[model samples]
Target: MLALEELAAKYIQKTERVLTLLKSVNVSVSPDEKKVYAVVDEAKRYLEDAKYYYEKKKFETSLVSVAYCEGLLDSLRMLGYVEFTW
Candidate 1:
């Protein structure tokens, strides 16, 4: 039972590690809605893949996951989902 709990805890912690986005990264986005829409699709796919890797307990792959989120966030900013604070 203790072992199971420990493993579960480790699993949760590892999954959470991939939750962060690299800070202060900036990219330009076009004001065009069509271009923003395309970016939204691409970014969503990447972030989803990243989450998939993170769930597999692959830390290296998790880093790639957050990279996807960062990409998506940039796209969202361009799409007007959020402002480009940077």
Candidate 2:
């Protein structure tokens, strides 16, 4: 059985992977509106929140954070920052 510490570490690693995937998206900067920039900001914030909740042992909240993280990724893809893979 995986220890709590190990499980936490794994969760954190998964969170980090999500962060990296978010960063890999390339967004174009437009003069009038900055869509990608906003999405990235939201994603970073959500990912941080996920980490916070995970550290606090709030699994449900962390899961919600992960949802937000995926939402942001979807938004990024919709905005053309990333190619649609799923």
Candidate 3:
């Protein structure tokens, strides 16, 4: 449980950092703007879910949520829908 908590904390921090960085930059999408915005919105929702689970002491679930959020952001970056680094 301690290890899971530690891992979850690390991921949460990473996701938060990434989100902060994202907010500081202007993201221009090559594809449909509405679709890209929707994906970004979904990722933000996952981040919120992660935080909620973390506060509830569900470290494993929090980790999963954060990972999904990170994956979605990475996908957007890799697909050239957003400009940012991890």
Which candidate number has the best TM-score?
A: 3
Instruction: List the candidates' TM-scores in order.
Output: 0.47, 0.63, 0.85
Clashing pairs in 2: none
Q: Looking at model 2, which ten-residue stretch has the lowest summed lDDT?
A: 24-33
Candidate lDDT (C-alpha), each: 0.52, 0.67, 0.83
lDDT: worst 10-residue window of model 3 = 23-32
The residue ranges of model 3 lying beyond 4 angstroms of the native Cα positions read: 23-29
Candidate 1: tens digits of C-alpha lDDT, residues 1-86 = 44533444444344334324323223344456565556655655666665566567665665665565566665565545445443
How do the residues 10-67 of candidate 2 rate in per-residue lDDT, one tens digit apiece? 6556756766754455634433346666777787788788778878888677767766
lDDT of 3 by residue, 45-81 (tens): 9999998998999999999999999999998888877
RMSD, every candidate, angstroms: 8.6, 4.3, 2.5
RMSD in angstroms, candidate 3?
2.5
- The top-ranked prediction according to lDDT is 3
User: TM-score of the candidate numbered 2?
Assistant: 0.63
By TM-score, how accurate is candidate 1? 0.47
Residue 15 CA displacement from its true place in model 3, Å:
0.9
lDDT of 3: 0.83
